[model samples]
Target: MENVKAVKPELEFTDYTNFEAEPIHPVEGLSQRIIAQIPGSSVATRILQFEPGTNTSPNGIQIHDFWEELYIIEGSIIDLELNEEFKAGAVACRPPGMKHGPWKSPDGCKIFEVRYYSKGQ
Candidate 1:
């Protein structure tokens, strides 16, 4: 894996105009802003906005092939896996292949996310 250069403070989250909100795949009422990424390394940072009444699924959870860490920056969301609600200031880390989230956001939410694969993946 190539080294990812450190992101300067001033360069991060400075331009929101360029980020177009798009629907999160296989999930409804969730939009995403791909903030920054390391080319060729599968490492990405993103902002996720969940519109009110969004839910991933009612049937089952979704699992990722990469590590995912997230923080609730504004508003709140419901963790279906935990059967509870998480508000701003909440944090979560999921290891590769961890089954999680069939999530819901009754009041809407905004979260910052960082994701990457394990070494050699």
Candidate 2:
């Protein structure tokens, strides 16, 4: 794989807050800011935001072909399948083919996430 993201100088804390978030298609109240990405691949770093009262049940259970790492930046979200609430500071790593989610956030939430494939896809 080639370097897909452009190099940049160190960014200030406030710089991250300036990225515009775009709505995730067909999912109401859910949005993301893609900070870095590998073109034509499932490799990227992003910030996912869920507004208050947001529910992702419409997406159903998710199973991906790539690894997913997530860190909750603020607020909380409930995993509908697990019936568990994960709050800020929580982290999770899901390997390829893991089934998870359809989540809901009652008070809003933000998460920093990275998605990538292993050596052999």
Candidate 3:
């Protein structure tokens, strides 16, 4: 099915304060505000937030079937597997089946993400 259609009128800037953040299950200190999504599918646009001292070890290494594009909107996070820290302004594009994450944030982080299945999927 096609992605969800935009329901709001065009705006010069979006006020994120109007959106409510919902907790990401099975993982504490992580939450998301979904801006748009295609029901019954993994296709979505969202803002992910990681609270300070949060670690995603419980989730373990992540490998998914959908493409994931992420932009660090603020703060930073460290990839446990890589021992590398990524700060704001950093961006990443992960194709399906790529392994990543199980991250930790010492100072908290905010990321804008888009996830969708590739045409071949």
lDDT of 3 by residue, 4-105 (tens): 454432345677756789998788899998877776677888899999988999999999888899999999999999999999999999998889989999
Top candidate (TM-score): 3
- What is the per-residue lDDT of model 2 for residues 5-120, given as tens digits with 9 covering 90 to 100? 54323444666668888999788999999887776666878899999999999899999888899999999999999999999999999999899999999999999999876676
Q: Could you estimate the TM-score for every candidate?
A: 0.77, 0.86, 0.87
lDDT of 1 by residue, 1-121 (tens): 3465654223543765488887877677888987776665557788999999988784368776778899999989887889989999999998877888778989899999998765765
Give candidate 2's error at residue 115 in angstroms: 0.7
Better of 1 and 3 by TM-score: 3
Kindly report which residue stretches of model 3 are placed more than 4 angstroms away from their true locations once superposed.
1-13
The Cα local distance difference test for each model comes to 0.79, 0.87, 0.87
**Worst lDDT 10-window in candidate 2:** 1-10
Candidates 1 and 3 compared by lDDT, better number: 3
Better of 2 and 3 by lDDT: 2
Ranking by TM-score: 3, 2, 1
- Candidate 2 runs further than 4 Å off: 1-14
Cα error, candidate 2, residue 105 (Å): 0.1
